[model samples]
Target: MHAGSWHNRYPGESRIVLDLTSLISLYDTALAPSLVLVCAGLERCDHRVLGISSEDISRLMRKLTEVVSRPDWVGSGIDQKTLIHVIVDRYVDRLELMQHLLNFTSSDSQELLQRAKLAQAQLRVMLTPYLLHSTVVPSSDTSGVDAPHWASLMFKNCATMHTSVMINQILLMTSSEHL
Candidate 1:
């Protein structure tokens, strides 16, 4: 029920959700998740975009669809798919979505462009091998892999705090050896 706080807190202020969860989950990725925290930080900032590439947008949509569909029951993480569905239905700002292609000259446009580029490059880096190898599980341990770096990927705010906590529970779950 506490869903509308950000709107009143930042009245008349435009908002954007960087959606880096889709970007971060694009591969088995082996990396521990850090992108969520970083993106959440960025989304809290005021910003705008000038031109977001279609390829990048397409990548997000694809990653969104894929991750949204494949809930990782084996690991400790949120039902990424469910959270994404909820966020898409409720919080997404259409004006921000529509103006994604503005021409960049100011700070806003540059930040948008930067976010897009980061996602685009991230997809290429993380997914290329997966596609080439045609498997979900990677060949080896990737514990040292760094999480993606971006802004605006938080799926839980005060309203969905419980869901966020559950997700962390899932991620921290592991083999009996860790216990």
Candidate 2:
């Protein structure tokens, strides 16, 4: 009988009820200090919520290269080792995609750019929770245009790689209009 698992014993009692006043109070009590820390970091220009440095990236890549792509690992049994490997592999894939996005370029084809734009928008829905508006605010805001949607996708070590192509397209469109 675990203390937290009391809910498991009485399933109906597990429901959480909250009114607006309680919710606001909870936010003030629990989240306010966290927000202050975020503000302090912003003041110090310390972006990246999880502080993902290049060493982390390199380590992840090296470990992933050593483990996940191995043929023997693919057919391995579903044990603790295999599960950890699978999770690491996924994280590595995300990091690779993030790297690709950080160096993203657009094709000359408008149709392809359009397709990429559509895909980028779709990707944003899933990415919003991971993104921060403050991180996006300092990016290039050309000719009064707001920061491109892709700029907002930087999170920890992963970003919206899908949006880089569209960002190039946006830049081209804005630049060409002045020419």
Candidate 3:
């Protein structure tokens, strides 16, 4: 498979899948469908889909679960339920997905894991009111009525806003440091 070609189309998905593959190769087990659900959710937010096959998602999820289920994960304060929440929550944007996945794979620091967990919880809490006040459909058009597309738009907005905030903070810190 030409992973690079797919990468050009899907951006971060290739790396995410590769990372998951390497982790799962060490263990010989079948992958799960829930993992694909998580990846699909993230892909929907990014507005990029390279026609990911069911097999690919299954393998990726298998590796993901294996990596997260390690004994040290619990000690780090990120458990299965937290992972599920992140995966199933359609409101979770690509940045949040990337951040959580990075933490799942490379977070040796408990502080970082805790922070990631907190961020996910905060996002969920923020969505609760919207979910309650609005209908099942998200209101995205001029009509101000709810539609399904609203969720994806909201996810993109959240990711964009988070990225802008981070960039601004970095710039501020850089200027202050120079001073």
Candidate 4:
């Protein structure tokens, strides 16, 4: 149910767990940092009811994983190979965190997993710049280009092509990674 609808049904309910996918999908960066905090908090809740095994933690981990799609990747002016490395490193970190979370036997395993997932999400975002700079990219001076577009466009020769090849390799590895 929607928040208003849910409120209508249980105005004085003691517990309410939200599914934030729809809201986060509409995000501008302005909301991301705050939403990440809210989502992180809700993810730490204990929402068991009527004897059902709570899946909030599992649900949250999956949603946070999905919520990481940043449109900034499309035209951030970073070379493509650099983008590829960043994405792969991010995914690898995600996988490692997920793996660690999967091994827990704590009484609060779900909460722990939720926390770990959030940590990973934040880490991935923070590490993006480092990943982009991980490769030693050759710099091409745009001394002649007067326009910003032309100047920005000149990072397209070796830096761009190499990035494309690197990105393709990362995609191939990611695809076959599950096989």
Candidate 5:
């Protein structure tokens, strides 16, 4: 089933069982990577450097968090713990990258810095529940799978993407300085 179709199904209705693998693949290949790329490209410049407005990115980010936090994934055979872990891990990486950028940002970039800070604060508020709850009752479908290992791998990929973006940005800065 297409990922868009999942949104059309009503909650608590009898529907085809969604495969957890497809769901994870959709997130891994699409959602998480897009979010990471956008977050990585966010800069302290006056112009919209990524060709997308901050409001649009903010809306997408909010929708992503909302969808993943819903219990619907549980009924669809997804282990909520693992799903949340993957998303939260990516979010933490994004937050860290934003903080790293903010620390080096100049005073002239106050607007961008404030926006990044706000986004970080909002994400933290949204993640509070997942962070506070420590109980893990493994689902039968995912019991054998190692969620932490998966999360670690996902985090590493995001980190790698962020690193590449940062390196490119640095190179651009240096090259432009010489021009």
Candidate 6:
């Protein structure tokens, strides 16, 4: 599928119609996995093989930012703590995909990497409130969900992924210096 088509299909202001299952399905079936495959193919073959362009990457990033920024999951009548798992999973996949593109793509590599970093930072800012809320000790009125434990696990996963990406970036820079 063309990246432009994916961008066009993204939910807009009417995204309130999207339930959690639908949103998760969209991410699993169309968005992140497709991008990962594209990145993998780009690594193995030329862009022509997958019909992807630098422009496609930029547009996809914008669409992804829009998707992530919108709070479609807010009113979905599910436990917010459970949704954090999905959110973390999505962001981690996005970060890993960005790392692959940063390391593998030859065209506009630095520009795309900068864009990815900015996006990742923005996501972290967005997630901070939720993380803080989750880690707080719950009162008797709240469900006994052990939110702090889940939040800690999710935070650790995100930190580990970030550290790996940074290590990869440093290695790439050092190896390029030798070349």
- Candidate topping TM-score: 5
- Report lDDT (CA) for all predictions: 0.46, 0.48, 0.52, 0.51, 0.55, 0.56
| lDDT per residue (tens digit) for residues 1-179 in model 5 | 47667765333233554434334321232333444444454553332225445655566677667667766443644444444445565577766865665565455677776777777776786555344233354576875777786566556665455446456767999999999
For candidate 3, give the lDDT. Answer: 0.52
CA shift of 141, model 2, Å:
19
Residue pairs in candidate 2 whose N, alpha carbon or C atoms collide under 3 angstroms: none
**Alpha-carbon runs more than 4 Å astray in model 1:** 1-45, 71-179
Task: Give per-residue CA lDDT, model 4, range 21-103, as digits (tens).
Answer: 23443124233333443444243343222222235444545666665653332344444343544656647866676556565
Error of model 6, residue 18, in angstroms: 12
Which segments of model 3 are wrong by more than 4 Å?
1-149
What residue pairs are clashing in model 4?
Answer: 80-163, 81-163
Report the poorest 10 consecutive residues by lDDT, candidate 5.
22-31
RMSD of each: 17.8, 23.2, 17.7, 16.1, 21.1, 17.6
Residue 10 alpha-carbon offset, candidate 5, angstroms: 1.2
lDDT for model 2 = 0.48
Q: Which of 1 and 3 is the better model by TM-score?
A: 3
> Which consecutive 10 residues in model 6 have the weakest lDDT in total?
22-31
- Judged by lDDT, which candidate is best? 6
Q: If both were scored by TM-score, which would come out higher, candidate 2 or candidate 4?
A: 4
The parts of candidate 6 lying over 4 Å away from their true place are 1-106, 133-179
Answer with 1 or 6, whichever has the higher TM-score.
6
- The parts of candidate 4 lying over 4 Å away from their true place are 1-28, 32-34, 44-90, 93-154, 157-164, 167-179
> Residues 107-176, candidate 3, lDDT per residue (tens digit)?
4688677777787776677565334334255334658555646667666665555445456767999999
| lDDT value for model 5 | 0.55
Better-scoring candidate (TM-score), 3 or 5: 5
TM-score of each: 0.21, 0.19, 0.26, 0.22, 0.27, 0.22
